[model samples]
Target chain A: MKVPALVVQNLTKTYDNGFQALKGISLSVEQGDFFALLGPNGAGKSTTLGILSGLVQKTSGSAEVMGADVNADAFNARRYLGVVPQEFNFNQFEKVIDIVITQAGYFGMTQAEAAPRAEELLRALDLWEKRDQQSRLLSGGMKRRLMIARALIHGPKVLILDEPTAGVDIELRRSMWAFMKDLNAAGTTIILTTHYLEEAEQLCRNVAIINHGEIVQNTSVRGLLSQLNTETFILDLNESLDAAPLLNGYAVRLAGLDALEVDVTKGQSINDVFTQLTASNVQVRSMRTKSNRLEELFVSLVRGSAK
Target chain B: MSPARIQWVAFSTIVTKEIRRFMRIWQQTLLPPAITMTLYFVIFGQLIGSRIGEMDGVGYMAFIVPGLIMMSVITNAYANVSSSFFSNKFQRSVEEMMVAPIRPITILAGFVAGGVARGVGVGIIVTLLSLYFTHLQIHSLLVVITVILLSAILFSLGGFINAVYATKFDDISIIPTFVITPLTYLGGVFYSIGLLPEFWQAVSRFNPILYMVNTFRYGILGISDVNVWFSLGMLVFFIVLLGAFSLWLLRQGKGLRH
Candidate 1:
């Protein structure tokens, strides 16, 4: 759709000493997509982001952002993208307003244009109150938010966040997610790389899981979670069942001192399990279902890809 | 509007910000060199000069003024860029510039230009300070201007390289201490090489900084211990080499991309 917001084709990066960081990664992000790139530590996620942003040099292959080749037309490619790096990169000695405005200046914005945009972004990010404060004086959450504001100052079509909520608290994290979702809805494409699976599951409609410099899975959120059909049900019984009985073909395990966990797969109804429990003369105190569609899919994908 | 205009805007922003950063910290950037040079004038020019007398048909005070001024220019220009670039690297704020739509050459030019501003600014301040101690004269105004500008450009390139290679706060101190310090001291800032034996004079010629100071000295007093053309040639040579080297480092993303 519209040439996709970004196109990364066979992107490869190998550091000196032959340490390959990205091994021919090929992916595309559609326009207005809330895309999440998920991976464990050292899973080539940063390498991929770095190359896409024109920070890290790619060893081979090509990438394009907004129809502009990242390596060949880096300046033009970058005009459509903004990046929030993982580390604190702003000058601590600079005032918050100056940091954002200077970032705008790098894009050739005059002071008249950059100043108002900087203030607007700062206000939107809730940094207006501390606009004049030195960057060193900002708290961790404030600093992270400042980075978001800075990235948006240029009014880019695509925004990349590299671990935007790595050390932030739950409230700020949720609010930041809301802000990102609103931005995406308003037509700014978001490409996020995060260690937080829950955030990915909640906010991202599309997900890409990278492991060991390769994409293990790239699918729609619903499509990925639908792969997990089984639900883990816990039953607390009033009386202890005798003989440590083995159920007929049902996968079961002891969850706690008085609870039994039954993993029910597709084609097996919950009613059948209840009927079978009644026949065994086991008195059920309470029953609860643990819906782990995302977790289950995540674990299986990571484990299977590791092999 | 045009690409040239955009590039100039970016370059101006970088240079302006650098000037502002240093000017804001005037106590550290401007005051220290002035005080140091004042001490050198008092101790070396007056205290020692009265005892040693003049060596090259000029007052020892005026003799050392151009050298001191050049020393300040070289060091400040070098310091301004090296510290600024390294600080950006250490803080990771360089990412802001890196992620933007600016060209690599634009970034290099912005930084080198910033260094040049600070270097020339501090040189002017030190030159004025030298006036109070000695009567300054200009033998060749063109040489004086050319040497100052060329010297600043060369050192700015060296500073950018240093910043590219520096990883930590402590890492930045290595080159300035072990390399820059020795070069400046041995560059004939304090004494002319004519006073030294023939072997020492040959060794002094190997220093790139000697050419810069002697070139400026020749500009100021119409006297020199070395060939002016030779000094000019070396200055141009290092400028090209260091300029190419700095640009290559930027292209390679050396120590900057990690």
Candidate 2:
């Protein structure tokens, strides 16, 4: 039988001041899977990743990385895991390459053994030119890539990235997405927590959504997204419209003077809406989903769990 | 790699990083102490020692030499670990070790060894500098080496504990300034405690630094106000005490793990 990449069971955390961060939540990630763990702010996402990284001690529970229990055999457990935290956590005074190599050393690699791996990861992340430069001088996006290189230097089988692309520019975000896809395709099991729902939708095959310290939904992205029966899109009108017209009896509303909001359900042809809009003399200059499909389902699930 | 080798490599990495940190900023870490001790030698050993004549049976300059070197070892050892550990905490870069599989003992030993490096490095520099001032003879190199290394280890542990509990910059310097400095001055570094009144001499005996300073003086001058054997035992006691307390602090994760 193939062992799971990660297994967290009945994890709970309560801060000293009485705030419970994780309420006995449990989840698993399969080997070689690109898994997304999504939640809003204060939704226990970072707390979960913290526990897995052994940064925050759990109140009560167990976490295993590649069949090694974290508490019982930390060396064995951490050997298979690589973690990129949300915030930049390297010594600012250290050079870019030094940070990556130092991390390799922390995993027991010699300077000679780590040097080539550092070069390969640095070049892959487009940071080889800045290898000798101090990390404090790197741009925010470059710093993010530097951290990714540091995490991957040890070549762990499981990689957990917490908001790795936050504050990164669009182009870099796309490139990072490509890098992550390549990492995943190369059989690295990745568990990612990101605010950009579209990024999750694009890169992840499996997802778990948490709300109020509980796992509200967990399944394959396709299965969970398939539950999204309706999608809402905002259309840009060529001309100002004070009121939204009935478009093939689809739910419609006026979002702004030059915008119309419409809801489309599954199995409905978008062409029908275009035809109805043309007949009503409302021409849309552009169209986009108000929220991505996964986002819509996430909000509804979180809201439902709240109620 | 075998587990033991991996652990050894991990330990060496931490020590190497710490050494690089202090060495990279030589202006702040190394240069100041050498300069400060030179000033001490000039002002106290040359300018004033000529007037005061002899202390115990040795010339005043030679009398204060061992104390000054020991003083440098203690201060540099304490400052090195305290500042480095606290800075790592402040920057949150200490998380690098927290996330690694290294044992807490390995981390503590690495930091202490780094402190010893600076402490011993400064001791050697200060000792060489002392030779220009007065003629010197080694009484017992074994005692001198033992006292210096153990004193360095003890104070490094002290600094590590301070950094663990410190939340602000001021907290790191508070103990060194208010406590360590005053105790070191009263540790019979310059004047023999025999010059003190009976009651005052007894009080000075309680100062732990007195034991360390007196023992190092005994190593260099072969003269001590305190019992040399008792002083050696006291140094060992303090090291064991501080070492245990330091390991406990790491285990508790005070001001460290959340």
Candidate 3:
């Protein structure tokens, strides 16, 4: 049997001040898979990543990278793992290329070995022109890109990013998405944590939602969305409607002069709503879901699970 | 690669990065110590030695040169590790090493090596400057090399401890100001403990810097206030104790880990 890319079981962490950051969480990422670890603020996402990255010690249980135990055999474990932490952790005074090259050195690579790899990552990330500039001089987006270049220098089997695209512009975010997809396609397992649920919904096949220091939900993306009984879609009507158009067995409300909000249950066909609307003289200009499916499900799951 | 070879690479990488860090800021790390010791050579060695003439059967200028070089080495060694390690912690960049595959001893030794490099570098610069002011003689080259290396190693460990416990910039400077400086001054840098009265001299023997300065002084002039063998032994004992304590600190993740 092939080993998983990352295997974390019953991992727990309690800070010195007695805050239980992780309360025995367990999960795994398959090899060559793109996985999402999603959570609200302070929901053990970062803590889990921290433990896996070797920055924090677990109180009990185990975490492994490509079958190498993080505690008993950290050298090999870390050699197979790469991490991009949530914060900007590199020295700001260091040059951009030096940061990536230094990271490669940490993995026991010499300058000669690291330089060519560094150039590859820098060029792929579009940071080649900014190589010699001090990291402090780069803009926020470029700084984040520099970190990405650093993370990939060693080409580990598993790459974990803690909100890698936070605060990045849309164009950069899309480009990063493309880069990540390419990496995933090239046989590297990816584990990502992010606030943007659409990124998860669009990119990940498998996901785990953490809440209150525990894995509240773990399943495929399709499986999680299948649990929602209904989806709310907003219809953009070509003309103003004084009241909601009557559609039998559907909860429709007039949200504005030009829009109507309707709840479409799992069994109902969207074409039925369109057919009913045309008959009622409500010409539909356009339609889209009221919000991201994953976002809504995540909010409802977290709020419902809250004590 | 073999595991041993892997460790060597990681260790050398850390040392190289640390050396590059200090060299990149030579104005702060190298120049200041050289200039300060030169000032000491001129003011204390020339201006005052002219009036005082010889002490311990040698020119007062020659008497203080080794002490001044040792003093510069101690301060620079301590300052280099303390500032570099603390800055890494302040910026949280130390995570890079903490998360790496390297052993804790590699980190400890690498930082100490960097400290020693700066310390010895400053010492040599001071020694060369001393040649311009007066004639120099080497009484015992082996003792000079051994004691200088030991002294730098011991204080580099001291700086590592300070950086581990330091929570702020002021904390890094506090021990140096209150403990190290007082010890170095009373360690008989400018004047011999032989002149400190019989009772005070006994008290001076307890100061570690006293042993280092006197042993280093004996290396240069073949004259010292304490037994050179006993002083060298004390230096080794302190290095072992501190090196073990520093290794324990890295294991505990004090101030470095959450």
Candidate 4:
């Protein structure tokens, strides 16, 4: 019942070249929730993030961060939010610690406070050892981590990340995820956009998918996965089939040598397919799920909306 | 820290970063200009002046000193900010400040102040070098200081505008080469405007740099070529105009906006 940390109402944006980036997008994020925004390239995710952070002007619509109108009171609104841009954009000549501390200063923090906070955030992100190093000297992943630490320095209530681990390695990505989850558990509302579906599957309790500048889906993770009525399972048959075998009551196709691909829809049972195959004197080998209902649901929704 | 204090800290931090970038590569950013200015004094005052003799009741060397100093101030101030800002754009690092909570006006002031600092620094260096060739007679210390400071601020603002609109390295060089260089030369940096034909003298009144160099000359020599009040009035007007334009560009997110 507490007020959501962010409430975006019909947020729209159009560039001068007549490209519509956001088409009346509306959504809300509950306080302290870890929300994931999933989208393909050029799907308005960055534009939405820009509008929320007050960097990009909206053609129409309104957004409120912690009840502060982003358009009307940008400074107050921005004060409550922190943004980690996808691009590596800090001044290369600046040291890592300076980058983090300067971000704190923008919100009016003194050196006494910002220094310790910067150190803490940098150390927490495993950047303490690189504090004195110029940002230009840091590796790509290190620079990206520095940006994350910079965003957190002001102790903003809401944190927005745009493709935080786009090109990062798996190990670093997981560590970053763990750190973000910890922040969210500590009560910072985290909003992130990513192309990594499994990351959303594991870390986010709620997910929003945007396509062609419009919100296609906004719901709890479980709720969205539940929308799928069909799932695909791959069965490694004991023997290879020369042709597509008949498996009644379910769609079945040859996956590969010694494998059968089976798809089960709503109101149909895998037992029916198994019973028919057994009756036909077919021997069963090993079996495994090829695609989860959740993945199927997401793919169908995004791809369907694309068309 | 309180909010007001945080904003000031952010402002100073950006300015410091800008200063560091230019200083770190002093050879590339600072050295070339000093060398170029030194050559100008040598060739123009020594070589050319020997043939033209004295003008404006002062030695050929002294008559061109103020013009040369103003020339260095204008070019350095304009170059410092324009190149610095353009480099940020090329490297796409200006986004660091863009995403932060700092006000647009503070960002404008920070870069402009950085540009002014470098401009004044280079101006003084060039002036000290000038002392080797001629004595710098101070007609009005206050006027001399005021003219240098204002000119620095004005050109720095112009540089910021250049950086904002420049999309490439060529974009940065185009204005300095075609616009700024020609204006400084045509502004009477070497010879007095009285030598020009009447038609050309009438056309000279329109050049802004002429007003600037002439104003600096008036300060150093206590002599007037054009109305001193008109020059001072134009400098103030440009400051306001440039300030407002730079702020507007900042708010609009010019090249740094993204």
Candidate 4 recovers what fraction of true contacts? Answer: 0.63
A218-268 per-residue lDDT for model 1 (tens digits): 999888877777889899988775443466768878766677888888778
DockQ for the candidates, in order: 0.63, 0.73, 0.72, 0.49
> Model 2 over residues B1-258: C-alpha lDDT tens digits?
777777788889988998998899989988888898888889999999899998888899999988889999999999999999999899888888887777888889999999999999989888888888877788888998889998999999999999999999999999999999999999988899999999999999889998889889988889888787887787789889888888888876778777
Steric clashes per prediction: 2, 0, 0, 3
lDDT tens digits by residue: candidate 4, B124-206: 88889999988988998888888888898999999999999998888888888999899889998887899899999989889
What is candidate 1's DockQ?
0.63
lDDT of 4 by residue, A1-307 (tens): 6878999999999988999999999999999999998887899999999988867889999999999898787777888898998888777888888778777767777668788888888889999999999998988889889989988998999999998988889999999999999999999999998878878888899989999999999999988877878788888887888766787677888888788888888788888888898887778888788955556777788899989
lDDT of 2 by residue, A1-307 (tens): 8899999999999999999999999999999999999998999999999888878888999999999988788888888889899999989999998898888888889999999999999998999999999999999999999989988988999999999999999999999999999999999999999999999999999999998899999999999988988888898999997777977659999998999988889988678889999999998999998878888888899999989
Q: Tell me, what's the RMSD of every candidate?
A: 3.4, 1.9, 1.2, 3.2
Where does the lowest 10-residue lDDT sum fall in candidate 3 chain A?
A: A101-110
Q: Regarding DockQ, does 2 or 3 come out ahead?
A: 2
Specify the highest-TM-score model's number: 3
Which regions of candidate 2 fall more than 4 Å away from where they truly are? A235-246, A253-260, A274-286
Per prediction, fnat is 0.75, 0.68, 0.67, 0.63
Q: CA lDDT of B27 in candidate 4? A: 96
Candidate 3: stretches off by over 4 Å: none
Q: What does DockQ come to for candidate 2?
A: 0.73
lDDT of 2 at A1: 83
Give interface RMSD for all predictions. 1.3, 1.0, 1.2, 2.2
